[model samples]
Target: MSRVRIAAEIAGAAVLLVAAIGIGAFLREQRTEPQSPAAAPLAESLAAPTQRPQPNCAVLGQVTPVPVPPLATVDLANGKKSITSAEGGYTVIVPTAWLVQPGIIEGTAWFGQTRITSYDPKTLPRPGPEAPGILPPSFGISLDLQLWWNPKGEALDQFAQHMLIGPDQLAVLPGGVVSVGGKQAYRTTIQDQRQYQPATGPVITTRQTRIVWIVPTDRNDRVLVAYATPGESDLFPEVEKIVGAIVLTTPASPTLPVIHQRDEILGRWLYDKSGAPIAGRRAEAKLLTYGETVAAFGGGTGLPRIDRDPDELFWLVAVTGPDLPQGRGGPGGTSPPTAWIMYEAPATNDRYEGAGTRFASAGTWPADFDALPDRCR
Candidate 1:
């Protein structure tokens, strides 16, 4: 593989990271709506019950009453209670041992252990050489309810089908369709592994199970609820109960917007052979762009890699666009994407030039296109 191809792949990963923030913002703006006020009964019924349950007790609520109580004002160590955030549009009954906080931005909300108040994923300071791990380690188990706006008219199942799974990083378990809030959803289980290096200890491999719920929001976004637990633990049933009880106050729209920015660069591109018969050299590629980055899929020797061997191979590249000048408000100039090739690969162009040209066009994609991909169907 050529170094250019390797660099393109790395660029793709960086693009995905930056694009994620953009996607989050899009979801927030397009899909989110103010939730209806909590029902009156939801508040009165959620008050602490007269009888106290065991410390390990878990409570799930079917409805969120109005006049929502303030869990933050009361001490959680005393006993378990059902709480609802009228502003957030969902309710959860947490044990006295767990702490719950209302989401301040968009539809974000949190429920879990107390140590979280000081730790913020966005603002947390980086660990130096002496402390290379999260200063205060996170609890082995965590749960979060996230809402995303989906401007694309993609169903929950369709979204699942397009999910890019990195073969080397994650193992996805067989998942099937499930229902949430009376709407169809896709539920899947994923085994994720992370490598962390601490200053005082050798590298550590941590494994965890993530339960994912992707439900179409009926508008521009979808609601994604996730529950993560230690790989060896069985918290599915408990988590499911919590997920099953969620009710949305916002109504779903029947139609989606006619246009989306992603459609412009999402398609197939090719470099036709100059002069040849049926055996003429030809190259084809597919690209998907979201937010500020793009993901490339297809096989061809036209890609670049620093090292290569005799083995046949395919490639997936995630990359960002060329940076513009700082004053122009864009990523400043950066090296262009490169291509690589290997003999006997499933897909290959007659020459690297053809592939390189195709990739370059994709790297600096525009907002309009004269042709789209058949594969998009």
Candidate 2:
């Protein structure tokens, strides 16, 4: 919603684009770490397969696994595989033929016939703020998915209704609850307008419908899965195939525990709503993984290694002090982040000595950025 952003290509996402969920692969859990380059297995040796790092929201520390592996490396031409959201701590068994990639924003990921790459969501060299009636094109037809925490514990249908009003959205068809993994999921379709004018040809216009599905998790978090395609495509079967197989957690899956286990870790540093560490404790923090950070304000090049992820969102929070803060950095505001150096768990605070980080939050990203009053931006 700012001049510069990586995701949120669609308009009017009031709360739709704030992704905060992760899913494993088609395997959805029951561990089986994928193979790596150097650690080739021996012919007759029994080393017990390398285990996947238990998914969790604790400080990842300075040296996370070198090849954390690109977000979506395994391309299944056809079959099944596990896709983890890592951010939201969920897993789904999607069709391997689908190219899986991180969602447009953090706490989100998606699968489809095409992969979104080679262009910047923040700035397109061709010039953006694209004309109306024409939605930005993607690699090909894709089904995007992501979910944010549901604080008030709203019912699935209520949440779906709130997600339908996008900026370009033209109409909302009636929808109702459907079964997915035995869970009640709200399914609906929004009529959206799009167009394209080529230099050498007449303007090409196509009718597209954003088919959306909203499902509630046992965790009180709501998940949104959308596939924007021509109105004629019958995606219900495939969509059901993907959403029907979601698994929230498995015995082997590493989960971001509500509280970090180690106190010495930056997570141990505690703070109050006013942004101050407990009276005698020092302030400290660490960078966040998808599960704890927003893709728009995510990792970028040239940033402190500690503060960068993939650099999707090109915004930085700069608070003047505890008294007069600026940017979307204030609680209930939309500021990016305040600390990179010292932070508590769920780690995405953008912080420093004068600025302390908050461990609790109403939502991720702006609502959770720590050190809201100390950074210079």
Candidate 3:
């Protein structure tokens, strides 16, 4: 985690990232294609909507209605640079002075400096494609946008409830249902400690509040838009304006038909324990993505009966744990899946409509479940 500091006096935030693409392709291929005009109406109706009424999402206990600005708000005039995450499936604009670093999780990360004036150069390495490297004249706040891999395979609202802390801290998902970036999203803010260094200076530690927006990309996938500030509330307004400029693409994939990258389960966490959220904990459970060829139910048969719904209605199933045993998936192998961790058995999803409820059949999940399995609740 790298902190933000652009000049001698000003402080900034931290750098964040996440895993990359593959499930994106799997998700696209599973869609139902429209064969008739009736289905076309349904598909066309779901066009990249800029606004929609609040949904019945109560999993987080309540809905904090937040208005989303138009995607058109993001443009060359408002940005120095723009970053898109194949893993997260979205794009965000940041200040022109911010340094962009490649992060496996955050896709691309940045030095959290809001503005750059002058800096003291030191000996520290700048963050790059392979590391959370820190640069000179900086330290303190952090910002990241990652697609949170849901371990419990629950709806976003439900997951928010389980992960919620009181308020003004990490897991501040009181607003599980928010609309931003031209898409429906989940909002949370976390204040935590992190360390960063100047070019030639010793490592420094600081506390900052990170506001996160968990936006669902597709079935079993979500992207987190996070901005950390030097103080609790100093940068909220500024960060809000930055995030408000986001515009989510429909289907949320950078590429279509075929995704060249594999959506590997870069890592898994045992969403167990309590207290401070546990990170980098060994995963005790495994997630399996199961999708079926939903046959169209009508009088016609054969070719005429198949349906086409670009939207994929899929869910993850908790499978044998400790290893990527499903198919040819391996530990860090190219074949592993990066999706949900079916937290509870016999869970149901309504995305399939008449497809009926999905049953996990049987499995054990942490819950006594929490993201911070390493720390005690």
Residue-by-residue lDDT tens digits, candidate 3, 171-211: 34355567777767777655444455768767766444445
State the TM-score for model 1. Answer: 0.37
| Number of backbone clashes in candidate 2 | 45
Candidate 3: regions farther than 4 A off: 1-79, 104-140, 151-153, 161-173, 193-207, 221-233, 250-377
Once superposed on the true structure, which residue ranges of model 2 sit more than 4 Å away at CA? 1-80, 86-89, 95-97, 105-140, 164-166, 194-206, 224-231, 234-237, 250-377
RMSD in order of candidates: 23.3, 17.5, 20.1
The per-prediction tally of clashing pairs is 28, 45, 36
In Å, residue 256's CA in model 2 sits off its true spot by: 9.2
lDDT tens digits, residue span 80-141, model 1? 45554333344454455543444322122222111112123344455333323222224333
How many pairs in model 1 have backbone atoms within 3 A of each other, for residues 3 or more apart or on separate chains, i.e. clashes?
28
How would you order the candidates by lDDT, starting with the best? Answer: 2, 3, 1
Model 2 residue 96 lDDT? Answer: 61
C-alpha-based local distance difference test score of model 2? 0.37
